[model samples]
Target: MNAQSAADPSAVNRFLKSVVAWSALFLVIVLLAGLVDPRYLDPQHKQFLFLLGFIGMWRYSNAFMHYCRGMYFLYWKYPRMRKQADKLGDQALPSEIYMVVTSFRIPSHTTYRVYRSVFEEAARVGVPVTVIVSIVERSDEVLIKDILRRHIPDGAQVKLVIVRARGTGKRDGLAHAFRALSRQMPADDAVVGVVDGDTKLLPGCVANAVKFFKLLPTVGGITTNEFCEVEGSELIRQWHALRFAQRHVNMCSMAVSKRVLTMTGRLSFFRSKILIDPLFISDVEADHLDHWRLGRFQFLTGDDKSSWFSLMRAGWDTFYAPDSNTLTVEHPPEKNFFKATRQLMFRWYGNSLRQNIRTTKLLGYERLGLFTSYVLYDQRVSMWTCLLGLTVSLVASIIYGAQYIIIYFLWVAISRTIMTLAYAFSGHSINPMYPLVLYYNQVAGSAMKVYALFNMNKQSWTRQKTTLDSGSGRFDAVLNQVSSKIMLFSSLCIFFGAVSVLIHLTQRAY
Candidate 1:
């Protein structure tokens, strides 16, 4: 079915929800700025005014991008465009296309059984398959060995890599595997496919991916569409599904059209030679260490981003195989707020910072379409616009009375409502309730950006250990703060505008 048919709506509800959310958000920002300083109109208060405005505008910029992207999807992406990708059939099966599945946290028995089944599928297709489980916990090593012995096919090359951590965190574990794998494999042993252990590969995923890699020499790697196996309770999982769909079905394709800036981490492949290249990883062994080691620069946090950026820098093309599918279990946020927020903060901040660093470096590189708009755009207005809005509203409200402030807010609310509805109705297949999600996404993001900005110096390399229960608390805090701040800012704006009008009236009366 085409995406257009799927986007049936609950538009009235969406519009109303957007009005409430946007109004509340604006109000908080204005009120908070006013409480901080009622005299923002004074010339001496310029720095203070700029600070509040900067925060509001930064939040606004983030929302505007997502809004624009949603609009892009509405007009361009529905299932009609999806049909084109469907036409590219999987062909030319290769016997030597080895599938490598990597796992870090799965229980030993489950890990073994998954590969046992996977090996069977590969053998059916006539290609050798290998499963590499990074034994994160020493206790899990025995279970991994058991899986290797029982599930590994007679002819398939099953390699068990044990990551003995002399150091702390996920970075060490991944670094250990990367360094070891680089030494063990050569450049020409066919493209190496990497998948998370939990991923259930579609029967011909490996075979079809081989066909894709063969189509272009510049094709550095490919990733498959992911669907969640676990469901229920946590709405965050659904958000992920939506995010996954947008990226795999849309952004990746767009990235390919414009030369990919970076590749996704989930289920990616690389030319084997790229791994062994002197430029990719160093030749030195960790002197009798069981696991190989690479410098932090060669092995960085957010491994997937590192690979994507490296591939681009090395002048290789990358693309996503949206039709090729991998279903994996989804871990959703618990109903708790902190757990969710913390997880998001870590993931968003960590990825953003790493990518920010990568983009800055790329500005000097010989890559096209890699320019970052945020870095280039002058935000002079952003530094004071919200504050200015607040001052004008407050002054106008006092002179003309509160009706003026209320009227202006109503206009702002109405504008947002219209945009939300227009965005939803314009062919994007997002669920009608997506605007609520969209609203929350913006408010939550503003809180995140605020936190990340303050704590930017305290960056951590280790990906946080997250489960459903742990993230809710953090997210709740963010949601509350965002809601409050936006409301506060809007109130302050009305106050300033009212005051301005009142001063003019008093001068005329005098």
Candidate 2:
């Protein structure tokens, strides 16, 4: 059966399954409420009960939306794309492809693997491929070139260009590579693929992504589905796996609307002409946002966000390819789980918050479309909601006995497990550790978002030994720090104060 014909029945089945799954989730919440407190469902205490209901419903509604969108993509969008891509089947297109791989202090083994995968895919595509190896260390040039030479298939039209940067950051290395590619004056129809040093492209990834360019002229960039090879404790491995699972759902949801938030730097394909724009390199390398409270600060990380924003501003659509996969070699930044995860979150969320503010300001409903715009706005609101739920529950537990806390934990466990099971329908297997990791991401990750928002100027490429200062003067830096602390203090005070008032009112009602 063809792509469209196959998608029809699967779509209906998925829709029915999603409805059943979500309805079951709602039932679970109702049962859990009774288990926690018989009065929770009692309508007699409408005021307090309504408040509690709103909190629970809001959280579950968000999850439900993601579930629905994810199912839509899994049952319809991804399967359709895969079938279409299969029909294309390694047929060489008219345009050349320039693959740029940027490396900075990557392990020798990882570098070899990345290069080998790139060359192999390039040969399979049967098109003229220019591989740009962007690096900082001069010593590694021989090693990288040797790998490239060994991997390049005989008679394949592949050219290797090695551009050395100042060892600054990935952004700088990318800038150098783009400039070099521009000098080559590749055809407007040609495509550019950017893969990080640690990422290895799966077979057919390049061919699959390039086909999208022909399918959609307005598409400026596309990012691949990513898997990982993490070397760490089981906790760390599960943590990474859980994150990618969540990312897959979110990416698929965004892809349906053709406005994926970020064209992930790990493996993204772009129209070669986009790179030729004179200002493109500058925008990617030195992108900054003028925060009203934080002042003007250059982004320290998140090159992916900058690139995505640039494309959106230039009126280009970004997409996610669920079929195209890349394996990222993941190494924990620090051995201590908490410390390692915290540092990673700081950079990840810091970039996200920075992009969120700027993107919403620059292009809202008109440019981002309805769904994408709403998702952008939701990012800001979700941070507070996640934290507020925790704070209120903790305060209520303190006032009404420890069972409230225990019951809250039980509710979280049940809710997140249900969400994970929903994700399994999208091809991810259920991991026993997912529930714990889910809570960690919601609670700890939300806290990090707060910090990242205030400290947007502070950034570090954790893997690479480089840090970018926000460049604010001493006085301004100190002021930013103080302001952040005050904001946190004020938020906590407001939450607890509200809970205190609620408790007092409940006493009066009794």
Candidate 3:
């Protein structure tokens, strides 16, 4: 079984209730539109549908091309590099390493497992590694200490340092721990690792991942592939599995260019020269983005993006391990699946968009390389394009009749199936529900990205329940919320209006 099937027996064994209800509503609307119209087969309407179809095709075609390109690197190029690293064995590893594991509001059992795995890897690597444990509780510190003592190999130079943070959030916690980690004065050639509290390192994960840094002198940072252990329904597990599978392909694609968008915070390693620098450490601790409306608000999440931005500006290349090397324990912040997923996407995409704006202006095609810059630019436009199929189809459905809607749904089903089947080439197990899930991810994810793009300063932590203070009065907060909604709603109206004009349906002739 591949990493995908290992997540659960298939949360998608049953269909989504939302899908059923949506289909019912759509059928009802289609019927109404059909009954009210008699020109569903008009040639002008046909011309409009044909023209609008191209936009949907354009967006999906780009994705298909990316998948094909990504598959070539993932299955072909990456394996060659992996075999070369495997042959080098321990020779490819750093001389000495420092790993900082932050444990804040994470379950104690998970904290123990994470530390134990880190210690075991240290012992296996047989290197002198100093682990800095950042914790908010005394119990986890004591627990990690016990784990370290038990896993230290005989005669191995395994050292541990514990730092307590103010517990404001992960960014603050990492700043506290990293400042201490820098104080240890690791060697100039050493490697520095950052591990989140909920992520566990797999066996030999450190050696496997860190070796890439030694192999590629240009690489300044490396993050490993991840599989999630989700605490939710089978559907959620499958969603996580599908997401990881997609991430693996995307990472491999970006790695070939030596520039991944984000070096994941769950488990990633950096060159000591970069992380140990005081300025670099400070960026991860309390980074802020300047925006026109959001103003200059400090980041409350996405420490990972901050690290990647610093690397980009400093001219350091970043990529990922060719192997799956970590397991993230996922707990949905809410019980309702839709609410939980939206919350997660808000934070995840919000990070990318927040950093995306700065990077767009900071590093253009000249510095960021050709394809990398294009991908970043696509991140800005893809949200609008993603909504085109549904938006155009729904508009046409309401006018030209249900036939248009039916035909649009057929295209969506067929297109998404082709997209999901392409994952088979990615070497991950394929699920029957993947096509449906992929559609949901695109539509819902695009919606979430649009919202996050507008509300960039709305940052928060799920486990910590921490948010950006804003430091504004209650009335000011209400006004800001109203302004955000108006902007989002107005932009969407403009988008729909543009589509209506393109289809020549502005006159609403039937």
Candidate 4:
């Protein structure tokens, strides 16, 4: 009998839903674009709107090009890496594995779940595992031991070492724990993981990821795919899910180049050789950046960025493992929807821009690979590019008519819906409201990035409610503030001036 594979009902249903969603959005765009009569458009109004239209076309076209390349790498090249990795996985790895779990002010249940999964997966890996649990309270130490007692498979070699930190920050915790692991003098091919307390490992997570170190000897570290379980409403769940889905695309695309932008703090595996280096330890512990205006300022947040920059400058390649996946337990700072999301975006994008600046200076087509370097450079421009279209429309609405604003709103709705539908392919649950939130993430996230670019020294931990001491000499601090404002204002003015010239609205761009 000839049998054919049947289509998945859920996938088919999702496809149909996407079709209907786009169809409706298109209709709305058509109606909105025609809401006002052409007679109402003055010469100046027409020119501004036309320039704004060019911006939209240019931005979307560029996005389409990048997305196509991303799809090519994700579906085509990544499988090749996985196939080679599988061959390596079947071999007996003589090297041992190590992990450093940093837990501070985390819920008891969450800590238990993380360690349980870590140990269970450690057992599956069938290797001697050394876990350094960095904690402030002794209760977490006791909690992890109980999980190990009840859950560790028989004959599984698991060693537990507890290090109590001052609860200052995750960087300090990771620093002490990682240095402790380094002092043990693990083998050259040994693999070590940096796991956040809030991140729980799934079965096969560690096993799937660690083999890559042996497979690609040049690889210094790798971060796994993350899907989040939010401790908030369903709205926040979808928001977090959307983020990871997008991250999957970017990571996979960059992985094709044998380089990824960041070594995420959540769940990353490193080569013991990289960790044991005095330079690597110093970067993670007390890394400082020399800014042109700000001089040398110690990094207050973004320990992950420091680790990644260390890898980059040290000439080690970083990668993303799609099959290796973990669950991130996210706790939004507060209940208020807007307030919570803003704080998160502010932190996330700020870290990105801060890293983007230093990373960009390393840009060379041959050095970083063409695609990866382009992606880093794009990150700097994207914060502003993402806002330009909307800014133009709003300016046009004030100078021209309310219809321009209405039409732009409809354009955003339709375009974002189409974009969100494409994200469904990443195996995330898609919500209708994702279009709205996606727009919010782009605009709000971009604004925060710009702000962070200027105020690079000011940083705060969202969960711990702690801030670095940003105090400096009063005269120098005032100069920094003034310089930041001047740079920000000048940058925006130059951006607007260039846009104005596109429609012959201003002579200044030339």
Candidate 5:
């Protein structure tokens, strides 16, 4: 049997068992907590109880969405999928695609090799291409120009747009590139594709995306699914795979339902009109928010989310075509989960808040909640729930004595264990070994949650760098350091505490 269906019988049983266990645990917690203190269901605590119900309902909604998608895929779109393939078989797309590579400090050798491959890919698919290299640094201007001249295929329309920004920030560089592209693109036609320097477009990716755009006039933007492509050891490989799997699954579900809140930047194609419009244009850096001189409306934050938000606010809908995919490496293994999550918490927090604010003005309050539940709930509200639950438990312990404290701790441990198991069992539909992989993942995620909450305000965006390694277990170095430090500290604390207790016991005997 294949990996996906290898242990179907056992997997089915395990899933049923997990459902029963979770239901029993919920019943026990409710009965026990009620027996201890009946006030939990009181009118005053009803808001918290309602919040708990809301979270439960959200999960049920997600499950229902998946079920609907499966039904649609099997019954409704089964013929459509086949027909689309049959019609488009071996046909060349007519639109010319220019992949604009925007970079500031990228070295010449890297530029030549990366763009050369990109150029070749475009050529292979019969798309006439122009590569516009927008240099953020003036110093690399001559070098990048020289690299393009030597590497670009003859008559391939390779042009260089060197941009010198007064402020050397990521946003500034991207803004400069967008502005330059807007001016250079044909006023009547042309779809400019935006891709990063580090990203590699897969075979036929451009043709597929352009074809979709050609067929669907309403599509203002199209993006492919992203994955980490860097070589690594088994553990690191698993980590990257899991990360990619989780995101793609979520995005696929979102895309099919028209629910994706923000379009990613790995490889996205935009209609030329959207970028060049007077409303989207601004003199400020690309990464920063721009205040419209025409309407006094402020649109802040840069990068992918910012662009998508601007488009959505202007009444443009983004369509995600998963076939147009690419791979780019993630920031390598972090110094610790704490450092990594600290960065994520701040970015997600700020972005969530900013999006909420922006979308509320556009979509209104009630409609905004639907979007928030999908995109913002896990990053912002789930963390809030965890924090509130912990605080309530702490307060209850102080007032109701040690019994509640023991029960709360036990409840948390049991919940964590069951969630880890459920995640493991879910992985069986993909790989039998995925359960074991998820066990490691669960522990790491829980530890990161602790770290994220502790350093929630440390806002920084530095990417963690990894040195190339040609040996086994390369990313495990930092993991070992962290594990050893944790063990050493816990051992010392336990030893001193045990000694103090022994002395106290001896004095009591005397």
Candidate 6:
């Protein structure tokens, strides 16, 4: 019997158990909602039916797509690819790895941990590993050297080159490292890895990714699976973990198509020749999108997105290393939960929105595969669709009764719980807090995306305390911010006003 058949009986049993558990939970939720209000199923409430359809189209459709894609990845694509990777491992390949680790003002302890992890992994790889350390602090040089001296094995062929940059931003730090690596004149087959200074690689991280290069010559870059070391409240920790869990599933799904969207900067591997290209460094240093409203603004953050775009533009396929794991140290950007979450979301969603527009315009369906291209388009549509449920709930509650809001919450709870269960089967711990965090992301994150779309040019690395130039002066920046806020406020008012009008019409019709 094949591997699938050898495990078929156990897999079937697990599937049956999941179905039973999910059905029970779902039925319980439905029964509870009915007990709260029989009007939840009132035949006369056509408005609620319309609202339900809208919610299904806007939210559930994407959820369903992710479910299907996740299953395909777990069952078909990953297993077949794993077998191929295993075969490739049997052959010898001349692969040199150059890692560029960018550090700004990371804590000394964190810096030491990151370097130790890198050097240890480099030794384990048993290849020529050159780590280009980019830092703004002169003091870190001594610390890094000491760590490398102590941690790296004595016989390991590892070299450390420290490059000091002006602390301008991460982009500048990375640029300096890339320039230094390019000066070395490495071979085209060499693998270049870019990682944040706050991230630690697990054992076999580099070796796991290198096999892909030998297996697929056309592959330009591969990103690793990332976990985090979050130091904060339980809520914050769970929130961060939940995001990574969702990210893993999404990355796996996209990798099946060999077009993973973003080669995450946390720990992404690339072809050495690509990093040496002048255009690649230039794009990474100064990448921007032309916005109709805000004009052309250089990107300040999201260097990962910029690098991913460059790879896509150059027609290089990207993959994800599911087995390669990195641990990121998370520090809260703001003291207040709401403020911290918003600032982080603003930077993240802003980068995504900026890149989404430019990538679609530049690459399009021809360059990006059909499925990947459609996913990119869906990013824009989902922004609006995600908000519809919340908006409609509020309007309907004001018109009909508060029970509508209760029913809406119940539905969200049930649906998100089901979605989170699917994620659990993907090998992540099924946190009890996941359902709440999932809903929080969908509702709060959607609003953040809408704000980001309007203020696409406003880019900043919240943690690094740096902002990108929007190709405008102080006066223009102020004006743009003010104008964007006004537009956002007006849009929100119009959306609610239209919902109110719809509710009135539905009330009269019924």
TM-score of each: 0.59, 0.89, 0.88, 0.89, 0.61, 0.91
Report the alpha-carbon TM-score of model 4 versus the true structure: 0.89
Give the winner by TM-score: 5 or 6.
6
The C-alpha stretches of model 3 lying farther than 4 A from their native spots are 1-46, 472-479, 505-510
Best by TM-score: 6
User: Predictions ranked by lDDT, top down?
Assistant: 6, 2, 3, 4, 5, 1
- Tell how far residue 68 is off in model 3, in angstroms: 2.0
lDDT of 2 by residue, 270-365 (tens): 998898787778888888889888888777689999999999999999888887889999989988889889999989998898999899898888
* CA lDDT scores, all candidates in order: 0.50, 0.82, 0.81, 0.80, 0.53, 0.84
Cα displacement (Å) at residue 148, model 3:
2.5
Evaluate model 3: give its lDDT: 0.81
Clash count, predicted structure 1: 67
Give RMSD to native, each candidate: 11.2, 6.7, 5.0, 4.4, 13.0, 5.6
Candidate 1 per-residue lDDT over residues 369-457, each given as its tens digit:
52333422222123234344445555656754664355445434444444445434433334433444544444455455444433332
- State, as a TM-score between 0 and 1, how close model 3 is to the true structure: 0.88
| Model 1 segments more than 4 A misplaced | 1-95, 98-102, 105-125, 144-167, 187-189, 229-232, 282-300, 332-335, 370-433, 460-510
Q: Which ten contiguous residues of candidate 4 have the minimum total lDDT?
A: 501-510
Candidates by TM-score, descending order: 6, 2, 4, 3, 5, 1
**What lDDT score is found at residue 309 in candidate 3?**
90
* Best-performing candidate as measured by lDDT: 6
Query: Candidate 3 vs candidate 5: which has greater TM-score?
Result: 3
Tell how far residue 146 is off in model 5, in angstroms: 6.6
lDDT of 3 by residue, 37-96 (tens): 445546656556566667767786777767876877777888899888888987887889
- Candidate 5 residues 96-185, lDDT tens each? 556666654444555555565566666666655656665556655666566566666676644455556543444555666677767676
Which residues of candidate 4, in runs, are more than 4 Å off?
1-50, 92-94, 362-366, 495-510
